[model samples]
Target: MSKSKKSEFRPNDYVVYPAHGVGQIVSIEKQEVVGIELELFVISFEKDKMTLRVPTNKATEIGMRGLSSPDVISKAMTTLKGKAKVKRAMWSRRAQEYEQKINSGDLIAIAEVVRDLHRTDDQREQSYSERQLYEAALERLTREVAAVNGADEVAAAKQVGDVLISRAAAA
Candidate 1:
């Protein structure tokens, strides 16, 4: 058996794994592979119903991180209140950029995606791709907010939605 390494994360701690969103660290395990010992963090994504194991040492390099601070969340909400910066670029190019922002695991960037894609009165309806990107960013954002605020996804989503809606109404 491999030896366990002390980690900042503990069981029941919520963390973000870039490719995945919010997950709870269920446990730490040590395993031997080909006679090499590795310490891992076992995380569970309840919404995705998936479990992921990340090497303890590689967590930071791989963008695995703890919940966003209140200040970070505040900044993201401020970003949502800003006017949308829609580019004149093609949809394909914009979609690619949006996907990158969502996967960046940066709260502010994800909020930008949500702010830009959100539709308000007198605005045209979103295309299918736009909707998809918006929902993806929104989901990632809400999960992080939920983890930080100790709220469920729905409540977090509503909070984010309210910010967007009020901004839209003002615009």
Candidate 2:
């Protein structure tokens, strides 16, 4: 790509930032530092009330990406329907891994977190931190799925919840 070309993201375009969940590209900004000009993509996360500015050249390197394709979302849904994989590691270690996967900006990894932490009827309750992580992953996954499907977050969440509930029932 050439520097003069337009960025892949545009204003009002929803994007996924690795550390954050769903954000919209607000605008492109140009700044001068050390007499060098830099263009930045300003993203806003309404749910988090946070704004992130990423350099145009560093966007991909930092794992900023557009919404997932339908095929990828289908795969993630499939992942949700599959059995959860709870590792034998300690809770602290597993929590760390879960947090890492949530921040990795990968849909399937986030799905795994949701699947593992999900509580079925008559199942044991989750630890506070486990619930926190589960909610975080669920929010992240649901936001993308919502954006892709043009549905509200609650409905999207229900859709995902239905998958989990049915899977647990079958298992």
Candidate 3:
């Protein structure tokens, strides 16, 4: 039915795809694949210099979703202010878990990665792998926050950093 074929996203709408960060829906197109026609949502990730086409009906199943709501964003900010929870597992195991959280495209989960891996100046330096994961999580979180708040990446990063720093000071 025509109603069933309608898309939830419009061109220029920002969306988050799991395994990727924020992207814009550039267009919707019908393309012939093999013998059948398929409707796809063309999404562009400007920062990553990438574009992806996803079947409209499968988008939700693939975990593609709209930007976080203001309440969700607020909760993520509160999450940042919470104490970090680092498991006693080995570094490699923890690294795998951190990577999974970052790629999951859940803002709150990504915030957990950022918080758990964050190290203050007085703390010992992170291993190369740890630093890489932290930056990745921070970047993902910053991009989403920037998109949601209508601010630039730098300002978003600073806002998140300020929250973490304040948490550190409180502890």
Clashing pairs in 2: none
Evaluated at residue 144, the lDDT of candidate 1 is 95
Candidate number that wins on lDDT, 2 or 3: 3
Q: Pick the candidate with the highest lDDT.
A: 3
lDDT of 3: 0.92
Q: Write the per-residue lDDT of candidate 2 for residues 38-127, one digit (tens) a residue.
A: 999999998888898888888887888899998989999999998889999999999999999999999999999999999986999888
RMSD of each: 3.4, 1.7, 2.0
Ranking by TM-score: 3, 2, 1
Candidate 1 versus truth, CA RMSD in Å, comes to: 3.4
lDDT (Cα, tens digit) per residue for candidate 1, span 1-171? 235335568889999888888899999999998899998899999999999998898888788888999999999999999999999999899999999999988888999999999887688988898999999999999999988999988999899989988998888
lDDT of model 2 at position 146: 95
How far in Å is the alpha carbon of 161 misplaced in model 3?
1.2
Model 1 segments beyond 4 Å from truth? 1-6
Reference-based TM-score, model 3 = 0.95
- lDDT by residue (tens digit), candidate 3, 109-144: 999998888899999989999999999999999999
Ranking by lDDT: 3, 2, 1
Q: List TM-score per model, in order.
A: 0.93, 0.94, 0.95
Clashes of 3: 0
